[model samples]
Target: MALPVAMLGPTVAQAQGWPTAANPDEVFLYPEESEDPVLLYPDDNSSSAPSSTPPLPNSPNIQPTSVRSLQLIGGEVLTEAIAQAFYRTQLGRPADPARLERIAFAIDQWYLDNGYSLSQVSGWMIDAEGVLTVEVVEPEVNQITIRYIDNEGRALDDEGNPIEGRTRERFLRRELQLQSGAVFNQNDVIQDIQSLMALEIFENATVAVDVDEESRETPVVDVVYNLQERLSRSFQASGGVSTELGLFAGVTYRDGNFNGRGESLRFGTQVGSRGLVFSTEFTSPYRDSRPERLGYTIRAFRRTGRSVTFSDEVRLANGDDARERHFGGGGSVMRPIGDWDAELGLNYSRVSIRDDSGDLAPTDELGNDLTLDDSGIDDLLTLEFAVTQDQRVNPSNPNDGSVLTLSTEQSIPVGNGNIVMNRLRADYAEYVPVNLFNTGRRQNPEVVAFNVQAGTVLGDLPPYEAFDLGGGNSVRGYGRGDVGSGRRFFLATAEYRFPVTGPLGAVLFTDFASDLGSGSEVPGDPAGVRDKPGTGLGYGAGLRIGSPLGLIRADFGVNDQGDNQFFFGFGQRF
Candidate 1:
């Protein structure tokens, strides 16, 4: 510890004045390029080593323009993988050559059916690189051939001899149910055959096709059809229901080729609460089969309903009630006029009324009463005309369009009486769309429809004159015989539908009616006028369910006075 100071000085270099920053090039020097003795390689001759070969210059090699080969390697390899992926992902399976060929054949067949007989699809393999190219070729059509044969293997004409018309094939093709030059469909052919069978003129129909194999370039088709004549008479039975009437049924017989001259006769009867209705009709098909039709119908009917009494006080009369019977017959001729159809007819009717008052006395305005020994009868002659254009799909179930009908019936007396009865009735029914959100299973509902009907008597009463409205079919809100007058009366009804489930629909309906009399002062007439105005309103709902017997219906309604009633019927309420 007591050594000399000069000999014990620090060996490490000490910092001097103004210390400088490091030189980056010198700090990061390459070992191979260094001249230091410790950084020498074994192959170096000098003590300081050097790189074996001098580093090449950092410059791109320039070549002649035509010396390089412009070849694509990876693109061809990736394209095959892309094609396979497309086949699997888009088609959901591996693509088979046979299946693709079948698809081509189907497309060719479609083209051939559309008057392009020469249609072909060509497939080519491009360099075997899993790439396929297809080309479609279509050629022009020449002519079409159609051959007709009878059930007995005889090709006959109007004379029943084996003969061919000059343009037989052309005519038959033109008359075919399906058109040529249109795409061919097996389903269409089958439907055409069925339609031909439905005509009732053919018992058996067969179609066959033949192709020419030698001339594949110009494919030819041969068609042959065989048919059988049909027999003529048929009968049908149909029945249904309406809100106005309960349950009804009818039967019809038709002679298609009556006497080999196309005439028809029909006879039908409908029986229900509307009474017994029978009709007989005849038509000559030869009389203008296109637009104008001439036919005649002779109808007879008898209807009855309950009688009501309208007095100063609402009262239900006791004892025997009143009943009415009507018998009528008429003939009509109908013809088409522009967009409307018009009919003219003459009708004759006889009506009878009977009143049985058990122990009650019949009273008149002057307190006078008479007891009748027999019922009263009145004869009427009426001339009627009607014009209508009904565009409804089915009268029983209207879904598409509306129906408008206008009818006028005037009755005149030919005897020694100055009495006349005039009646004008018009019915308008339309279907309007309902903007209902969340309609569920129902596509649309809420049909805004109505019915307006008015009847009036225009002459002096001969003690037998009567105008009555009410009952189940007339005005559901009021009882039968509650509305009677010499003036005028009107009834209107509106209905809306709501679907419940599959094939089951519900309907809500409302009715309004009023009766008016002629005289301002209250007449003491028993059958003519009432002391107070007759007005009524009712609301009801019904359920319609689909069944083998058409639509089964049930309705329950109540009047303003809280009288509940239920109606069981079928079909529509119009």
Candidate 2:
């Protein structure tokens, strides 16, 4: 009878239009009705291989303890004070049992964290002798064996070691932070893996630690590094178009790790509608067992349809289009001091130029015609000294760190009197990370980048040697060399980059630049220079796509004068 009454009440309520759409917010559940929450662990084990030994227990943060006569049984692995530091424990005082227990657990946890995952504290007890005994099962590393796996083409010998004749062990040895007979440190292992992968010769690197069966009492583990080598030679070709260069194609060949030594040889050529270029470079990171870098580069190029002038009036009249040819070669030697490099270099270039139409008499950008005392051909020899510090994590795309470079060059006349100048240039870039959402991660999701460059020529400056500030490489919203051309200039850029997906990113950037040269000048005056038209401003957004070749970059920019321009390149603008 009671059940029938309850059922009739629901029917009565429904008949009275009491039933309507349900509101999820009005629902509530008791804790007893809910299932237990599941705990999740991040997979440190490799996804490609079978799971590693079961994960270690997490160390709990414990309060400090004051104990008297603390004794660790396995004292050979660590000093007494060092073990106490790990637990933040003190001696010669009254100690709480609970706190002492935490200290004992923390000591074992420390060993596990340091790559002795199998180690433990077998016993933690206060004996009748009035001493606290902590038995530690610390394992030592007995050997380190480096294995080069998946290396074919006679690169390795039968014992799985790098062939002595074909391979230079020092090339691989220098990258390792771990050594034989050292305690196993997970941090060092991780860093060693990264360092090995950074080398161009290795496609992949891995490390595995295993216990030695024959040496169980001492409990020694062998650290093994497995490396996979990449092809010794590679070639790449690419075609691109920009508002400045119009259309261009380039091809490059590289033997970056020749003869298993960290030496690089590269040759590249580019042909475009406005210019043609050929260049070759060779670098040896270590010279004759010394920590010095030596490199040489040779280049030949020709360019046209680009104006290097300051006055718009003169540019409009003369069209400012000049055909120029240049051939140059340079050698540099650098000594590494800590993380910075101090370098000295010498360069010589033979430069010749003519008007697009004919060989006109020399004239300043302000239209003062004069005789330069000879043809426009000039052979110049330059001595340059530079200091550079690059701490960026990645060359193509950097999320943190800074790079600073300062260089000075003195150009001495060799062929004609047209080459006598002192040049100075300074450049700096910094990257700062941004995480507005407070994501609890070590790596940032976005970056704010800044760049600044200033250059000046103090002595007699020829038109070809003048600085041109514009185009995709400079102010961005203008065509090549469209901005002020002058003996002195300063440029600044700021960028904000955010990741969109894996290997895909976006950037918002702004550029500001100015030149220092007055357009009113005497043509024959050694200080003859034209005033920069005005300051240049460019703002844009760009897309960054990561590829095997490199980062593919594209930007759409707008100038202060409302001109729109587009740029395409292979890496970051700075």
Report the number of the highest-TM-score candidate. 2
User: Per-prediction RMSD in angstroms?
Assistant: 28.8, 15.7
- Give each model's whole-structure lDDT: 0.45, 0.60
Question: In angstroms, how far off is 382's CA in candidate 1?
Answer: 0.6
- Candidate 2 stretches with Cα past 4 Å from truth are 1-77, 80-138, 141-170, 197-215, 218-252, 258-262, 269-277, 286-320, 355-373, 418-420, 436-445, 516-532
Among the numbered candidates, top lDDT falls to 2
Candidate 1, 122-202: lDDT as tens digits: 331212223333334332222334444554556686697753322224323433544444322234344455544433334
By summed lDDT, the worst window of 10 consecutive residues in model 2 runs over 35-44
Model 1 alpha-carbon drift over 4 Å, by segment: 1-289, 302-319, 355-375, 415-419, 435-446, 460-468, 471-474, 481-486, 516-533
Residues 1-574, model 2: lDDT tens digits: 0111122222322332322212232222221232211111132121322121221244223224335566677665556776555433335555444445434444443454455444555555554444556666555666666666563434467786764323477767666777776655566676776666545456446666665646366566677676766555779898897333458998988886766776777788778775566777777653323444354433343333334443333442356444455567878776765667677878877665545443543554455433333665667789898888977654346777899999999987677665677989999999887875443121223888999999888776665566777778788787665666666789999998877776677889999887655212223322233333546899999998865555688999899888979999977897
Candidate 1 colliding pairs, count: 0
